[model samples]
Target: MPEIAGYRVSRVVGTGGMSTVYLGTQLSLGREVAIKVMLPEALADEVSRRRFENEARTIARLEHPHIVGIHEVGRTADGLPWYAMPHLPRGHVGQRRLTGDPQRVREILRALLSALAFAHARGVIHRDVKAENVLFDEADRPLLADFGIALRRGHGTRVTMTGLAVGSTAYMAPEQARGQQVDHRADLYSVGVLAWEMLTGELPYKADDALAMAIQHAQSPLPKLPPGLRQWQSFMDRALAKSPRKRFPDATQMLAALERVPLSGGSHGARLQDFAYGAAARLQRLPKPAWVAVGLVCAAAIGLGMPWRHLAEDVADGEAAPASSASSPTDASSVSAAAMAPGNGGIADGGAATMHGAAPLSVADQAIERARERMRTGRLATPNGESALDSLLEAVRAEAGHPQLAVASTALLDALGESATGAIVAGRDAEATHLLQAAARVQEAASPSASARANHRARVDKALRARIAIASRRVNRTDALRLVEHARVAGLPDATVQQLRAQAERIPDLQGRDPGNLDGMVVLDGATRPLAAFVSPVSRAGYARFAEVTGREPALCRERISLLRVLDRRDWTTPGFEQGGGDPVVCVSWKDAEAYAQWLGQRDGYRYRLPTTAEAASLAAAGGARIVSEWRADCTANCSRRTVAGASWRTDSASRTLDPDRGYDDVGFRLVREL
Candidate 1:
């Protein structure tokens, strides 16, 4: 256990990549607090150690309900830099009880945005904003904490946040991820990601690797959520735009926009604390003397070129007495590098020339014409994601040689996506995601025009989507152990793999022991394991597995489509497929014979289902009387569900050969299960 200055360590609270938080009681004040300490291993380097100390000093100055205020900043006896703040007992937003309630999600979003807005007005930029940084009080009022890598206006580079790359790549703004000079809006982009994950109960874009996930954040389209939640699409759209110009102007605008949405759901009476958590009102309540000290720090930061954090810390320790600054904090720039686009005459890095800006409409028309001409002539017909179709359009437009960013970033993303295979295969998804995202941000930054971005987006979407599919394969094969191993190796989310396993286990199998079903069941001998199982009816769960394997649903079984799809179709309203997995499978399907047989053979250690006519008749006779007509797997590629086992769909009908390729409506299947 570690203790903050004047506090006795109590218990472990939480941990992160660089630091661990602990619960402690102040020895002198007799109050509980959160003690944050950077890991000693991370402090071995000079810069990292200093940066940790700097974070403590930075957070000590902020005074707002939504922003954590540090009461003590000190180094531990072992020399580890540490700080203590008011203990928020409810834990983090994405952890513990705040995980998925929608209204709480909204409240958290509102609180964070308000906090960020307040910070920005104070000329502070919280460079890193993520769910882990958001804490809550016992009453569930959200608070934005952790300013380890914050950038203050007029501050010199004590330790550059860009060099350290302190934040999680998944939540970084496009510009921040690209290592560009940023503004307060960068925080808003991260807030957008938080909003999406909060509302949907999962992140919008997921990949086996971090680089790929980052690429998704940079280039992928806005995540498509369920239809009912589509009303909030525009809100998320503005929040997550790759270009900052497309997003809310600031956190204040975002907070207002979010408040307008009528979305509901969270804990009862949670809204009662809305007023208590207002950052604006809290800021107004702060004594005039404190604002005067903060104002002095800001004035010195701009006029004398000092680190704002150091000056602000002076005020926190009761050492400031200067008058308030002549200028207001609103004077700080709101727009960032992401919001500003290169116009016709803009020059990019390395002295490269970019977009020869003609009229916006004129260039768009000309670009479209050139694209059509290339398609008409069939030369360089298809565009790839690396450079995509930009080269062709550029060649035809004005002989401009090439787009500036196109040359710069396309080559980079091409190499990144190509190099991420090892990580994806080795189960290092997070690393792979960051690499891919870096490239995607570059590509996003390069597109000079909306048309260019659209074209790039379309091409990149196809490429990235295909990549995600490979990263996450949906399989329901006999060798489940191998599927489990592959999924683990690919770094697929544990939840997804667990869900698949749970679904597999629910299918009822004999588990190598006789169920002793006196009604109609026979577990064939191991020597005849090829038959799969001998059963008269397939359970609902068994048929569900069948659909997963073959893709299409069993004709008369519960549908494999989503709930929305079921509601959309009028016919499904009547005689719909039963959702319960234990019920017998319904409808005639040629796939039933093969699917049912395979699952049983794999489930139990014996074969009972895939037997031919002679083998099936011998084993099936052990059970009681059953329907004579049923589908079986005894045909070739062009075979139909019409007649398997030389039988018809009608009961007691034996016209198996009469229509081997024709399917009937009355046929059904009997399947077995496994754990």
Candidate 2:
């Protein structure tokens, strides 16, 4: 190991393509540390060197219980970039003896996902998430390590070399492997690969070289787990989906699915059936020559008077298994025999093949067939992995550039749209929104025209806005809050979410302070105060309630039997025209309006005042039309004359100054509630 300042390098512990990790002791702290030094060649370019430093600085700022923290970062004596971290001597999850322990797997996945969730929340994506990067402490707790290839949100795709993505091919998301931009979901995909490796003791896809491996990741069908591990198929399917949109939206969602994974290993019969499924799948993969050779060997052994059935029974008793094999079959011979039973099409459990004279089904064909089956079973877009839409989406990816790609994608989109419609009708707007979003993602992936994409997006937005409107109208505060959360979970735009949130948040203010009068209100968003106003001018019934409760008298009117005004024998009770209780109460002066508003505010334990000229204009712009000109709090000349706003029965002018102490035949007022 190269010498480092303030530390004594002992020996090289591990090495990667870009960096070499050494076991060293910091002299000042007297603690062992893992010093990771960038390879001289990897940092030869100025762009690479700068990206390394920028990522290092970003990583150093992250502090989480399950995330490895950087101790110090600097240049080595040879001018190579390097950073030191706490040395975890217990090795990593790759070396751990898992023994198919689901509990252990759950624990490891949880810790790593927690770390990822934290880092992602801070705009960091751990582009390289593999078993080797998960280190174990003394307590066997997994800590996510090796963020050397991490990409900060919006840090630009130039952080990596021009044509290469920075992640292991076996664990890399397809999008990342294509040298395309990636987000946190890419890390979740890698985690799925790691989980597969842990449970199956092998990578899901394999090839002779890196490029071939990446192609397999991009094109191959998702691998099926061994029968005993079938409970995780749903989780695995989502985690390994070709499209990130189909996968768990984030680390937290993945963690939730992980937690829900069944802990019990199911009944023996179910396991045997699963084993038969696996055996059939394995048999289907064998070439014709291999199958013929196996048949010939069995025939010869039987013809030579070899007791093959007895030998099979002996093997079934577990006497002839390989010592190095970790998989000890419990009843394999019988299950394999059953897997090839007659009239079963050389398979079991409706497995992928039909064994017709035609060639065997390709991976994409199998995926499409599976999707059809799922659709038949009414599993279009649920249960994450086994859904019809999920199968169709993966098929689209596996058959990229194929003629049938469009067919499969169209099916997927149609299913998603139908499912979303169903969800909306069922009042599951959040689920509906998720489905619509998935449809949009599918269209985008297909590289639709800009107009097509925009049209699809507009449809989605309209649906979400309708849901927000539904939530906004919820009479109960709790129901409104729940719907708001649903809107957020549905992945509504931030602006839309804020709108729904504002409405939901005002529920308590409206219900508690203005019970039985919650309807017909408009919220003015972004105002300093949480303010709402009556949608129309306050009606005769509302004014009458205030007058009755406070025993307030009607004001002198422009045309009424009053001493100070025109004696037209009319007041608020009769505004010189026949009117209903719901109609605007005309012939009310600004002071009478003010008194009624104050009385209503006192009755409701809320502050109610006449709308300012600006507020009234906003209400009108928002479609809160008024039948009569409303009184406004705006005034001039020391409040001698108050402003009247809005259209009236007599005129459509925006505003006209009126005397505060006098009433008019065509004037009324609305109340603004301060929340």
Please name the candidate that would achieve the greatest lDDT relative to the true structure.
2
Candidate 1: list runs displaced more than 4 Å. Answer: 3-5, 96-101, 156-158, 161-164, 264-675
| Candidate 2 deviant stretches above 4 angstroms | 268-675
Query: What local lDDT score does residue 15 receive in model 1, on the 0 to 100 scale?
Result: 86
Candidate 1, residue 451: how far the Cα is off, in Å: 45
In order of appearance, the predictions have TM-scores of: 0.39, 0.43
Q: Per-residue CA lDDT of candidate 1, range 317-416, in tens?
A: 3444344422222222221111011222212222222222212222432343333323222222133422324433443344443433343234333333
Candidate 1 TM-score over all chains jointly: 0.39
lDDT of 2 at 643: 89
Report the C-alpha displacement of residue 468, candidate 1, in angstroms. Answer: 54
Q: For model 2, how does the per-residue alpha-carbon lDDT over 49-166 read when each residue is reduced to its tens digit? A: 7667876776687777899888777678898888888999999888876756878888888898878877886688888899888999878789998777788877778767677777
